[model samples]
Target: MTISLNKTIAYTKNWKPTFWIALVLGVLLSLLLITLEPFDNSNSFSNKYFILSGYTLCILIPVLLVHPIENYFYTLQTNRWYIINEILYVVSTLFIIFLFSFLYHFYVVSGLSSFTFASIWDFIKDYGVPFIPIVVPLWVYLRSKYGVIEVPLYDKENHKKRTSVTITGNNKSETLTIFESDFVFARAQQNYVDIYFNTESGMQQKTFRSTLSNIMKQLPTAWQVHRSYLVNLDYLTAVEGNARKRFMKISKTEETIPISQIYYRALGKRLSNSPQELQN
Candidate 1:
């Protein structure tokens, strides 16, 4: 269905996981190459292990180098990530590794004199075609292990119901009581927390001399999406950017609060299960 096709799935742009995945894949592929003795590698002057190491580098280097470029494009289409995008990423990564493998064969496995258009075509049929069957399953496994699913938003009539809540500070008289639904977000600025909320007149801010954690205690419904920011899920409008970098937009505010990677998945789950719809 069109709805299923358009549904967004989580995409991780964090380099730490990417590095580990590439390293593990490289090691596995190297081991396979050693076991199968694929290609006429015995004829080469280099040691078998040494040539295998070159192939490992061919896989590792391309993934590390190409990921940043992929991340750049992912950021441009942040919340729109779908299965098709992930498929493109996998295909592009394989193509890059294929090119690197071709170069490795041309310089290390075969001499410069052997280079020819037909040689490249032969390499594809001999090497690239076989690589896909092995690599595609690995990619599929990695994606299923790491990917997050988005939940459908359902209507809730009481989402905007106002309930009076009081928030206090470290010092006496530094206190505020407002309708919970009107609270937008709070930012920790050194010793003070700047609270933004909606008012009959417009948006208003109240500075409380308290730590973010202390403020969070009073506002149980609020979530700390970043180290310095606490947001009311009721006001959350959209989440933008990939897993590496993300921002949260609040209703009635122009400022976009940064969402830390540590809290990204939790936030996604919270929004996905929330009574209100999360606008992309």
Candidate 2:
């Protein structure tokens, strides 16, 4: 499931110093471009401040939009595998910046008539031409942000919170909202994960199409018992069975949770030090 920044907390959680650094660079570069007039095009003394304002807007607009996109992009980057997420984030954001720049050129700077494909290409190129020399330093500064902490600062001790996690069913539009604690366990069934949780009536389940490994890291209180199952540590009642086949059971749910040989010992150690409060 793809998660996005919903509020200011999410923004602060995802943002880094590098973003502010990028904005500062954007401002300084705008100033430099306005002062030097590198290309030496027809610009008299009277129009200097006007040219400065245009350059400042051009940098500020894209910088503003790109950073927010980065907030969501980093969420994807944290949840998914690096190679896949990086490619998607980069390509998507580049297009976003281009689209923003295009609109800025059309509606703000030049008229809609001058906003053809050729003009847009020329406009982006004009922006890039000045950026070529400083690109390396910008890359070096921004690269550090790629590995920024996704852990939210709000709950310093425990990142876990009662959050609304949406589960989209077979149909893309069909969805259900479940509280984090109510969710019990998930099992991999073919191309989807069959998620099980508790309700006032009884235990309910929903099918979510996603890799188990990906979802494993996403759930804060969940732990993998077998290759197929991820159980909530909060609901876990006791570990049962013998050396041949160890299994775990949860409160109010009699469903047999198998503890495979791989995760068997690790599960024991984890539960050993687990807070007794959750066991209540």
Candidate 3:
């Protein structure tokens, strides 16, 4: 269990998803409060709506503030993010929301004048205890739905030394040879792999009656970015997109290759250390 919790997972850093998740949570919480009529003192519908707005803001403000701050730290040490990190993020954000909600309740809903430690403790029992059961599971579900696992970085130096590579098909006679530096990317077709490489004349493609995995073993520098594509890091020029959707651009090719989420972190880390110019 400890080892499982310590395993690394993709940390969501994009603001768009953060905003949407907070918005949805706020809306849902507001609706639940409205239906339940949790606060009997706010009997008047207008007052209830105003109080609900405060509750919604409490949820939204903490989440939006916490996510970016956490993301900044995550960026500094990208590889260290794990399941435990995510759990702590969610719990810390919830604690902040609880503090905000407690203050709002003390000043506005309850119309209390004194702000004491005891009152805060009392409010936690009244409010925070009930919220945990519902919110934690919901958070876990959302995280699993959106999260991705990161792959470990490959040795970038291994690919740099090799100048030429020979890819062989099922038959010995079927083979294509090219300079390793000139190799761009490879895509798997039905039963053949299309190899793209640079030539003095122009960019060229050679089809081999072989699988992508078979081709990958021959090229030490090639990385399988997706199920159907293997890219040569030597030719990778740019990487773009948010946590959910990412694309890579090769130096000599106009085509953009889709990067699978599992490979995204490893690719970014590899490119940042590479001599090639990588535009994110």
In order of appearance, the predictions have TM-scores of 0.53, 0.41, 0.54
* Candidate 1, superposed: residue stretches over 4 Å from native: 1-5, 41-45, 147-265, 268-280
Q: Write the per-residue lDDT of candidate 2 for residues 1-280, one digit (tens) a residue.
A: 5532211111222445545654665576666766666544426435655645565455445555666665565556442223344445445554555566567546654435544678778766876455645643564446433443222212213424567676664567646677777778999887688888777888898777776765655564455567688777667667789999888887757688888765565556655655434333
Top candidate, metric TM-score = 3
Candidate 1 matches the true fold with a TM-score of 0.53
**How much is the lDDT of residue 78 in candidate 1?**
32
Q: What is the lDDT of residue 81 in candidate 3?
A: 64
Report, for all candidates in order, the number of backbone clashes.
Answer: 0, 0, 0
- Can you list the residue pairs that collide in candidate 3? none
lDDT of 3 by residue, 1-280 (tens): 1244544456666777677777777777777777777766758545677677668888889998897778776765533465667888888888898898899887878777988888898788886778778766776666555654443344356444557878899878888888786788999987889999878898899888987767876875566788789887666777899988999887777899999888787777766665654422
Put down candidate 1 lDDT per residue, 190-271, tens digits, no spaces.
Answer: 8899998878998899999988767876775566677688887667788899857899887788899998775677668766
Task: Name the candidate that leads on lDDT.
Answer: 3
lDDT of 3: 0.74
TM-score-best of 1 and 3: 3
lDDT of each: 0.73, 0.58, 0.74
- When summed lDDT is taken over every stretch of 10 residues in candidate 1, the lowest stretch is 149-158
